[model samples]
Target chain A: MAIDPPYLLFLGDAADELAAKTARGVAHWRPDRCLGQVRLPGCKADLGLPDKTIDQGAAEGARSVVVGVANRGGVISEAWTDALERALDAGMDVAAGLHARLNDVPRLAEAAARNGRRLHDVRHPTRQFSVADGKTRPGKRLLTVGTDCSVGKMYTSLALDAELKRREVDADFRATGQTGILICGEGVSVDAVVADFISGAAEWLTPANEPDHWDVVEGQGSLFHVSFAGVSLGLLHGSQPDALVLCHEPTREHMRGLPTYGLPTLADTIARNEELARLTNPAVATVGVAVNTAAMDAGAARRYLRETEDALGLPAVDPVRDGVARLVDVLP
Target chain B: MAIDPPYLLFLGDAADELAAKTARGVAHWRPDRCLGQVRLPGCKADLGLPDKTIDQGAAEGARSVVVGVANRGGVISEAWTDALERALDAGMDVAAGLHARLNDVPRLAEAAARNGRRLHDVRHPTRQFSVADGKTRPGKRLLTVGTDCSVGKMYTSLALDAELKRREVDADFRATGQTGILICGEGVSVDAVVADFISGAAEWLTPANEPDHWDVVEGQGSLFHVSFAGVSLGLLHGSQPDALVLCHEPTREHMRGLPTYGLPTLADTIARNEELARLTNPAVATVGVAVNTAAMDAGAARRYLRETEDALGLPAVDPVRDGVARLVDVLP
Candidate 1:
């Protein structure tokens, strides 16, 4: 007899938490735009043959199936594994939002590996885009900024991107690494092959003769540690942007010990951006400061930004307030 | 014609600076007691004929030679290379206190590599060590402390060693890796083999087993950023110390960001010393706060230290005043 499409199954008493987390993930990637309606399966008892629900779904020939197994410690039970395998063998590309605790499920990991499927560790909400032509093109100008991890680089980049859009200027922000790209949604990977490709594309994209547009790139980690400095520098040398904005947290430690923090002060964020013009042999249009609102009081942060901008003769703009577009406008 | 025994040559315009740096290096390893009179070739010459000077040094039978080159931009020069090669060809292990400027000297670096000698980039006066025995036997604990390339790990280690000696303890201090035993002087390379060996040795030489003696080991860079964490943790696990002393600069950035700073405070510096500690596990015995006394007034520094101590409950000691000894004494 013919069977019907398989439905999502949420096991355990805390089904709502699992369903909520799954929804959040779905909303994060906006999967509905690409993948059609996602079905959330309630208790098997609600349907016929409660125990045979998984086998029933597999037999029915589902294209894509999303399942949630609430393993508090991330362990996939033998019964769950059997059900998952049945679905996969039935030609369903299953996606699971298993609790992180399932990381302990060696059998599930092995099963996924063997089946050519993946068990992804879901993290902060992120979006992924595919290049239209399968060609990685270099953006107009590149701006790289990084602070110690968790120093709000993503938040700042988003705020800047929003600002740029508000001002009727087009600006694209990209992350520099695989993890970064996964998080930021708009940057090129500085990995060897991609970096080389981007470097070549940059020559034509950011020609010396043309007025360069700004590309804000955020670097992760310290300049001296976990830094893709070589690759980033290679790109910078090749791209030769009109402006280079280095975002820094105005902390006493970063100031006292780090050599990078010793770079001459900017009169204002705008002037700081402009100073980059001479230092990098390009016209530094303006310097944009992305202050960590969480780290310091607003008043203190504003004062520090103002003093820095005044010293550098640059317009100081907050990523949250002015956005990336206004900041780019301030640039030469 | 009778030839004289070959000796290492040191050439520099500022003999005092070279001498001071060289002396500091020697003191770091306590070479006078371990390696005996390390020859200092006193003379400054252009050595216009680079190849000839190398040949002449080779003509003499020098076991090891040291050369001093002026700091042009914190790097070594080609002239220094000629002299170093001559010493090497003459069968001498070579060392140099070439100012930071000559560090980029390709020739010197090449010659050192070819001759299996060391080219000293004496910019960071600390982080210098000499190996008493070529082999780092099991049970030896080595602690290195430095942030960045030259954050005074060597200086502090040496100072601590000297303090240990003052207490009538026999101690051996040696540099490892690029700055110390592995690159120059005498010891096995501080690579995986050395790391493993250290781990094995630490197990037998734990403080719990030997309460009368202390084995202090340190590392440079953030515990998470470099191989330091693995090697240090291995050593700590292998050889548990009674106390772990962390030398830190209490800047707002490091304090707020580093997880190590969040370690549970020990009761005062002395009580803290009673427990074995690593960056992750070690109960902080004493914190050696390295502050720029020149930048902040002593009173201000004192206040900062007091606040840190109060908040953390671990006694904060200034390296400048309390000294390494008092800090060690406070360790349980």
Candidate 2:
């Protein structure tokens, strides 16, 4: 019998041996290619082959490829991104470790999208299909939200998680990058994969998953695409969240230089929230303000909020004080 | 004489020729070198220099520096920052046109500080400043506060000016950068330069020039040194103001990565305001929040305000609605 082609797995230096073997199993099934391992400098010990010559192995038509990476903490550097992009361009289906939170996935996806390549989720991989329900079913109440770069999204997510846990709510706050996989499955940092996993897990746990057993997945950035770009929307569409909370500040100067959606004043901000509510059709929820009190005095801030409330018909909460538990109550 | 060594004025394309010339005047005063005019690309303009030329310029002597960026929109570009850093390292004191907004200046300052250089303020040719007793002070009752960025500061300052004028108060806002020059005779950006010029003008316009007029000067940025590395305490020791209004966000998440001196909470934020009040010993004046309300409902926002007020002892005001008018009322 002709020798079966070996499977190849490409990863950062952090994958463990079992993960590599699991990847190898996926590779072993490929008919045309044999599993050939090419380990770079930083390949994780769990993934086996370390420092294998990648260039030489590729020249030999390694049928299957597996790339491994070590856990270096935080977001993958640009250098790693460039290397991964190069590997993808070379016709390798990249399986990245979902060790880092999903914060940088949108950026990576944007980069990949620019290159006309799609990143796939190695864990719970599935086909794309539209849901008949038209609304994402909320399985785990976990949610993550953040801004493009420095908009305090991670802090908000983490704080929400901490707050939820404090309230004795079985909330699982997973950062979409590093902290995500630990809470979910051993899925790579592929956003699609994560979303699929989330959706699948929600389906699997539904009815059985108590409302208190909420999975509060923290989003990486702002609502209007940017940080995780279309991921949040995609997640919302796929999962059909029960409620959406927006964290906002109410100042013209703060809103300045930002992409204007006709939301300049507190009144305008509320109007925009309504518009978002109408668009997403999710149970429109309360708005949360991460007020930087050090920046403003209490009385002045109260007056401003009062005026803003008078303008907008809904309620608002401070994420720091009221916490996520209160947010859950306020959310429809 | 040898044409006064051909004075050179470096500027971004957005600067008015008159302003450029005025900036060059400062350079002209330094007799040691031949001035070579170097024009930078404005935020909206294309970078005229080729990459090779920029590289060469960066490699050249530090004294052959360029000055004058009208806006920071393009300052973050590698080519611009690298070349500018190179020029500054080659021994040039960069005097650029900065916006009078608080948010604008700090970024510029941060960038410059990153390269171990400081942005200098160019005095406006026609502004004035003067001091008045408690009765004649512009912010006598309302403590006029200023922030650091180039754009936000200017907007706030101008808005305050408009508000005071609307209230028919004998109040005037002075740029502290300009006042610095008056006290010391030199600085960068319009505010400081204007402050300096006004200070000089105040002297020139004293009983000797116009002794009856009192001036309220506004400064840029916080007294604390905020940079990529971290926030430093006592960055604004000698440069402290009579009364200060600090801007901050109240979310713990927002404050997480930030270098703060106090606990990270709404209450902490409030306490910090009091701390600032105690530290500056300035009348714990009006507090402001540069809010963005696009994500929340107005009613909830109002409650948030009440909560914040209950937390902090001081009162808050919306800069857009009540800030300017209150400042006018507070003016002595």
Candidate 3:
């Protein structure tokens, strides 16, 4: 997909917080589309995008102002609302993945209307889904599961998809979260689905009877993340992936939203994921690890990857930097 | 709660199928509330309630017709719609726990309004729920987890609650499914909730305060049931139960809906439930077992209970026949 020339990310006050997830995603995965980033006052963190205010983005030919950060609880903050209004006022269309609708905020709604800009909610899937019947298909299925939320499941899946495609393989990417929806443009936001239909969403994305094909399904919350494990388990069961890539960030010490809970060991995570996956497909296995070493320097990242690979007995790669060739090679 | 007078249960043609779940529940849990059962033409098996045609129920002073059979996938069949119409035409209020809303079925809705009768959709929750924070609650919480769907989680929880209440203990029954909701008149339908909010639904049902009391939470699907395991895990984490009662139907040989998958052993289930629960509350433990011996003879039932008790080293009881006193004795 070619970059939609010059995108502006509205991080507002949360540029350093959860919304920064989207900012980092855009900067790293779709840098060609980025113009620059916007941050609240005193927020000096580099999001890898060009630093541009709403007006500056408009002047730089940005057609869309993407709400880059994903807020916890998906609530729209007042700061975010203000940034969105400014973007709309500057003649740019707005896109948001937050659970709260941008059209519901009156000021932003009016600004978009007056400026003739469109509103897109990436989290609201457009298609209907049916309940999964746990049927087996012909193609190979690969899933990326993480140790915690925001641990680069999407990044790993995308990298794997890209790598496989570059090798002329018949591969497809299935996005599970909103940021992934924004990146891929055509995938279900599985987390936004009703619990009864979550597996259905997975089934819809990875259809049956695709012989000799590979589907790289992006994963969601960790199997141990108390906040959203239902989505995780549903995706795990629905995907019915025979092979899995364990995505982990070595620097994170605790589970998200549960400060008292430490991360499970790599061996435990692999075992747990495999066991859960095996509930549907008994032949399920963990073939590789996708190490998120974005926080580490080059040497440290390599060491972490090597250590993870040694500890878990799987091929490991920092997919974003080193490509997913190593991980793909281990697939059945 | 006293049984309301003269209830007619609509079994339609599903008397021998999924609706049998509801039929069994009503017969075993609240038989006094039932006046008779309705089945389609050529139907012969008794659902434990006095078999009555629509006209017979009306003549017998039935004030309400309950949609007793929970069809697989919660589909409202043509026969069911016809039965509902007759019940409404007879001026009887109708109650349904199916996923399909009677209010959404045009003929049923019109019949209900025309006859000035009420339609109750039990599975649709009436209240809002936020995401669970996994905070420690003051009072003790005991959850009844099952080995499979329709394994008597609700029956076990309700029985335990009643036994505790009989003993003058401050115990409240928390319902998680449709039949439980119909019986209790309140509680979230955990499976109907959006994937991300399943945990939140659990949190809202059982609040954090109230020391010295006990909350008996009815569980939903099993942790090993691939079709609905997400809902099961969410309930487990959200309830944050200190103690659990493992509910099982020993006669079932395979996992529900999955023909190839064998049932997890009792030891494995207890260990799995405890492990998942411990993620939220380390103090969590399985205290007892609720054996659903509905499919067995009394002699065989007692022997099975004794065998399970010996193997797991937990107090075991048929909540319906034996009462839950032995189970309650093991609570923390």
Q: Better model by TM-score, 1 or 3? A: 3
Superposed on all Cα atoms, model 1 deviates from the true structure by an RMSD in Å of 18.1
Judged by DockQ, which candidate is best? 3
User: Model 1: what TM-score?
Assistant: 0.36
DockQ, per model, reads 0.02, 0.01, 0.53
Model 3, CA-based lDDT: 0.81
Candidate whose TM-score is highest:
3
Model 1 global lDDT (CA atoms, 0 to 1):
0.41
Residue B233, candidate 2: how far off, in angstroms? 18
Model 3, TM vs. native: 0.77
Q: Write the per-residue lDDT of candidate 3 for residues A175-251, one digit (tens) a residue.
A: 77778766654577877777778877887788874677899999999888888888899899889998999999999
Chain B TM-score of candidate 1 stands at 0.53
**Interface RMSD for candidate number 1?**
17.4
Encode model 2's per-residue lDDT on B125-216: one tens digit a residue. Answer: 33333211111122232123222222133334445555656666554444334322322233322212211121222222112113322333
Question: What are the per-candidate TM-scores when only chain A is compared?
Answer: 0.49, 0.43, 0.77
Error of 2 at B167 (Å): 30
Which portions of model 3 show Cα errors greater than 4 Å? A1-96, A102-120, A126-128, A209-211, B1-95, B102-120
The order of the candidates by DockQ, greatest first, is 3, 1, 2
Measured by lDDT, the strongest candidate is 3
Chain B TM-scores across candidates = 0.53, 0.39, 0.79
